[model samples]
Target: MESLNKNQLALLTCVIALSFSETAQASATALSPSSPGTPYSQLSNKVMAISNERIDKQLNQEINKVNDVMATRVLAKIGDFSSY
Candidate 1:
């Protein structure tokens, strides 16, 4: 009976070890960053691309506004060139 108990204990210990190893592996994979080909990475790239495009558009608008102001000032300084 003692030998049988010993065998059962050993088997239980092995099962527990295997389960812990599997759990650790699963958690490690979950915590790791997603590969570039993954959907999550693709989505992030798309979001960044959109954000950059928006920034470019806003910069262009501001540049245009400044140009318009400068042009108006230059025209005012020229005074009635039409008479010349």
Candidate 2:
């Protein structure tokens, strides 16, 4: 396989993702709706199912948890290094 540059890869990925999402949405009324069962649609559907407020709340909580952990580790390291 040929190597693709970062920008080309990113653009290609986005294009493919968009295609699958559009196809899945179009196949919503199909008898099988198999594409919707794929990870792409499952994630899209999950996101669509929830409200924007809930998404923001979850994102904020995740960010807070990450920041808290990082702060705790940094403080611990600084204290340990300073006492040596």
Judged by TM-score, which candidate is best? 1
* Backbone steric clashes in candidate 1, count: 0
Best by lDDT: 1
Instruction: Give the TM-scores of the predictions, in the order they appear.
Output: 0.47, 0.41
After TM-score superposition, what is the CA distance of residue 46 in candidate 1 from its true location, in Å? 0.5
Instruction: Give the whole-model CA lDDT for all candidates, comma-separated.
Output: 0.59, 0.57
Look at candidate 1 and give me any clashing residue pairs. Answer: none
Estimate the TM-score for candidate 1.
0.47
lDDT of 1 at 63: 58
In candidate 2 the C-alpha lDDT for residue 65 amounts to: 64
TM-score of 2: 0.41
lDDT of 1 by residue, 5-66 (tens): 67656755655565555555554554467644567665556555554555555556655765
